[model samples]
Target: MSAEEVHNRISMLRAERGVSRKDLAAALGVHYQTIGYLERGEYSPSLFLALRIAEYFGVPVEVVFSLRPFPRLGSEVVK
Candidate 1:
């Protein structure tokens, strides 16, 4: 069996938005370390938290999390 993995773009999104980990953590009602863990792929957010994060960032939930690694933004997809 493959090891469980949850891929997210929290760090990239946060960087693009210029949002601090502490600030997002406070807004999400979680410890700042939780944000770090999520960013580092050491933890995955709950459904509620995932929705909250998407809403907070003003993006679709699909923009934040995915079952597969996403192509780089603005990069063309290979055929």
Candidate 2:
């Protein structure tokens, strides 16, 4: 899969926990934009950052991120 197919587990976990992006950002000591970027696939976080996010969400890292097979260019994958 192309790197863009790397999904951020943060969004899903946040939804599950009812945690807002702002709250996560505060916990991570980052700007809210950083969270938004990660959630939108516009940014790929470092391993350390990924671990931090997963820790904050009280989940294993793999639960949040996955190397999904790359979809066809004009198609999409539903969650």
**Which one is best on lDDT?**
1
For model 2, residues 1-79, the per-residue Cα lDDT tens digits are 6745677667767888899989999999999999999988888888899889888878888877777733433575443
- Backbone collision count in every prediction? 0, 1
Minimal lDDT window, size 10, model 1:
1-10
lDDT of 1 by residue, 1-79 (tens): 1356778889899999999999999999999999999988888788999999999999999999887887887778553
lDDT of 2 at 64: 74
**How close is each model in CA RMSD to the real structure?**
2.1, 5.1
Global Cα lDDT for candidate 2 = 0.80
Model 2, poorest ten-residue lDDT window?
A: 70-79
Model 1 / residue 35 / CA error / Å? 0.3
Best by TM-score: 1
